[model samples]
Structures are given as C-alpha cells and as structure tokens.
Target chain A: MERLKSILLAEDNHMDVELTLEALGRHNLANEVEVVNDGAEALEYLYRRGKFSSRPAGNPAVVLLDIKMPKVNGLEVLKEIKGDPNLKMMPVVVLTSSREESDLIRSYNLGVNAYVVKPLEFEEFVTAVSRLGVFWAIINEPPPGSSRGIA
Target chain B: MRMDSIRSILLAEDNQMDVELTLEALGQHIFANDVVVVGDGAEALDYLRRNGKYADRQEGNPAVVLLDLKMPKVDGLKVLKEIKGDVSLRTIPVVVLTSSREEKDLVKSYQLGVNAYVVKPVDFHDFVEAVSKLDVFWAIVNEPPPARVNAG
Candidate 1:
C-alpha cells in the first residue's frame, strides 16, 4: 500500500486550528494532518530538526500556512521555502484571515502557490476549508519527488 | 456594479476529449465567468496578447490559465516562460493541467512559476471531480493579483 502523504499546518491560533481540523475532518482527511503551532516549529518539521528529528522523511503533500504566527511568520516561511531549490517545489498555500492588500501582494510575489482568505462566517469558512482540503490534498498533484525529498 | 470585475478563464488544451470533459465539469458548476478555449500554445499566446482572431477581445487578463503541457506550436512550457517573463502577464495565475506525471516536468512547471499543477485523472469520474474542484478553487476562491483590478 502506498504511504499517504501528510499535511503540515502552521497556525498559532487554537480556534483556527480546531476549525481547520474540523473542516478537514468533514472531508475524512483529518488523520493526514500534522499540526505545528508556529512558524519556527513549521520549519523544524520541514527540515526534520528539533522536535521533528525522528519523523519519517518526505515533504508534506501540501502546506496550509497562516500569514500571522509567532516567530518567523508565514511570509518569512514562504520566502525561505521558495528560495531553496530542495523546498521550492513544495506546494505552499497561504491560508489567512487578513484581506490586507500588501499581504496578498507579498505572498504572491514570494511565489505562493495559492492565497485563500479565511472567510469570517462559520459556514463560509467551513466551505472554503473544505474546498481547500479537497483540492490540495486530493486533486492537486504535489511536485514530483516530494515523496522522497528530505529537506 | 460587480460586472466589471468578472475575470475570464483561458484554457489551452488540444485533446478533444479532455476539452469536452473540462467544459462539462465546469458546466456542472455553472460558473459565471467566460472560459476561452484555445487548441494550441500559439493560439493561447495570441488570445492573451489579443492578436489575430482575438484582436477585439476584452482588455483584462484571465483570472487563471489552465494550460496543458503538450500542444502544437510553442507548447505549454514555452508559453509559461513567456508569460512569467512578461511583466504585465507575469501576475496572471497559470495552473498546469496536464497528463504528464514525470518528475522533470513537475519540477520544471513549478520552476517556471506555474501557480499549481494537477494531473489529469484517467478515470472519468475522477477527472470530472478534479476539474470541478480546480474550477471552483481558482475561479471562486482565489483572489487574483491586483493586475486584474487595474485592467478593469
């Protein structure tokens, strides 16, 4: 059996994490998610250092990143990932609440794969996350070799 | 009041079955935006630049471009390079919807600044589902770069 690719979620807010996990659960995808609470932890997971040192190798199928978080932050993480060739091909989706034009502009400028604004309403947010989970996790193909890449 | 913001979708595909399937999948959702189909990469460029048969086409860039890798005249990768190279067109999101699963192709597509890459599923049901989700995500969920607003 093929090993299912994991999902790395970098989000600081408890509510958003719960909500996002709930949304993914609705699609029967909650099991594949591996949550990290901050940008620094996100990097650790990606690099297989710190708390993630013993985790199995291979990049996540997709990264659902929140723009605002403690430590490095989403845009910083995006820049780091996109700059490195080994991690450049990894799909990074900016899942955020801010509608600030600058955030959108900078995220795209940093080569973000997709930018999705977190909707305010409960039903809308669920719907948005559901669509994201389905497309990124199930429909969109992760860059080839991600399943074998260590960094 | 909102009509001016409507963004078109440009689909560059040569295969008739794929084209029909994509159209049918999109039709299932009843998307309000126009979908312009081009048979080759050259025509895709022509449409983007508003030249030849597309001379009088609308002024705004597409919300997203669904490009197939293999096509006559120029091909998808070349088209992608051209799009990302041009300052005005660079901001337009390009999603590679191709059948190839080769690692080299995947790496090159991402490197070329293609926004997303999706493999065309062989199963009919899977194909339709993929297209529908992609159409919904790109057209309805994503916020295109401010370039479209400026063009509007």
Candidate 2:
C-alpha cells in the first residue's frame, strides 16, 4: 500500500474545518489531515517546535492555509515559508473564502502554489474541496524530500 | 452554461499521444475550454507572443499553461524562465507536467516560479485522470491572474 503524506490544514474557523474534513472524507482521503486552529499553531507544526517536535520528521505534502487567522496571517506565514530556503519547496495552497484581488495578488507574489476561493454554495463547496483533496493529495506530485517520500 | 470568464488551456507537449490524451481528459472536465496544442516550447512562446504563424491570434491570455520539460526547441525550463521574466506574461499560471521526477528538475521548476509541478503518471488510466484533475482544478477551481496589457 502506498503511504499517504499528511496534510496540514491551517484554518481558524471551526465550521470551515469541519466542512473541509467532511469533503475530504467523502472522497475517502481525510485520514491524514492534521488540523491546526490558528497561524501560530501552524507555524509550530511546520517548524517542528513545541507540540510538533516529536510528531514527525518531515514536512507535510501540502499546507491548506486560510488567509484570516489569530496569531499570524496566511500571507505572513507564506512569506516566512517562501523566504526560507529549506521550506521554499513546500507546496502551499491558499484556501480562503476571500475574493479580494489584493489577497490573490499577495499570495501569488509570495509564491503560493495555488489559490482557491471557497465556493459559496454547499454542494459546490463540497465538490471544490473534494477535487482539491484528490488533486493535491492523490494526483499532484509533492516536491522532493517530502514526507510521503515518493520516488 | 459555461462561465464567460473561462479561458483556454495552452498545452506545450511534443508527444502526439500525450497531447491527444490531455485533450481527451480536458474534454472530460465540466468546464469547457479551448485547448491550444503546440509542438514545442518555441511554438508555445510564439503563441503567447503572437509571433510567426500566431501573428494574428486572439488577444486574451490562457487560463493556464501545461508545459512539458523536454521538447525539440526551448525546453520547459527555458520557456518558464521566459514567461516569468516577462512582466506582462509573468502572472500566467504555468504548471510543469513532465515525466521526469528528478529532484533537480523539481527544484528548478519551483525556483522559476511554476504554479504547480505534476509528474506524468506511467499508467494510462492514471495519466488521463491526472490531466483531468489538473484541468478541473486549474480551470474551474483556481482563479487566474487578471488581464494585462500585451504590448506585442
């Protein structure tokens, strides 16, 4: 059996997290999601400090980041990740409900791999998340040195 | 009805079979998009720049570019550099779709600002499915960069 790379989901909203998990579960691909409630926790997880120090030894396949957060914003985290040489290869997808052009431009300029605007309709949202899960987790090839260790 | 904002997908692949498969997979997607197939990176650039045979082409930009790494002339990396280097074309999303899973290639593609990097699946079914998922995700899910003035 192929090992699935863990997904780091940085979303502060409880409802969004639940919906995202449900969507991924509908596709039977939500087994490896590590949910972080805010940007600070996300940083802790990614940097493998504090609680995440003993969790894993490598980076997640992809980080689904929400723009609005408590401690640090998605764009700030993105800048931090892309600014670092070791973490620059990590695939960061901005999954936010914001349709602001500024957010899109900032995310792209910061080297976000993909930016997805959350769908408004319930069924459409599910479909979007399902496709996103399948694409990023199953289809898209993670960068070299990823935790999945694909060759 | 299809959304009016949905743009075309520019595929720059040398292999005829791959092109056919990609087009078929794209057809399977819900979003209707015109697939512009080019044989090599040079031709892809020409299409983007509206040069040579593409001199009188349409003015709209493609929603995304599925670029193959190896081709007859001006390989994928070169093409990527050219596109990202150009101020007008830099915003276009370029996904590197290739068979090579070499670390150097992956690193280089990311370094050159590729939006996504997908390895061509060896299995025929998986290949088609990968292309299809890519089509749906890029064309339907992802928001493309706003149009810019093309001074060509």
| TM-score of every candidate | 0.91, 0.91
For model 2, residues B1-152, the per-residue Cα lDDT tens digits are 12346688999999999999888899996667988999999999999999999999887678889999999989999999999888778878899999998989988998888888899999999899899998889888887765552432
Chain A TM-score for model 2, please? 0.92
DockQ winner among the candidates? Answer: 1
Candidate 2 residue pairs that clash: none
Error of 1 at B129 (Å): 1.6
**Candidate 1 on A1-151: residue-level lDDT in tens?**
4353478889999999999989988888887888999899999989889877887777888899999999899999999999987888788889999888888878877788888999999889889998888888887777765542121
Off by over 4 Å in 2: A1-5, A149-151, B1-4, B149-152
Per-candidate iRMS values, in order, are 3.3, 3.7
Per-candidate DockQ values are: 0.50, 0.46
Which candidate number maximizes lDDT?
A: 1
- lDDT, candidate 2, at A131: 85
Give the per-residue lDDT digits (tens) of candidate 2, residues A56-123: 56778889999999989999999998898878878888999888877887777777888889988888
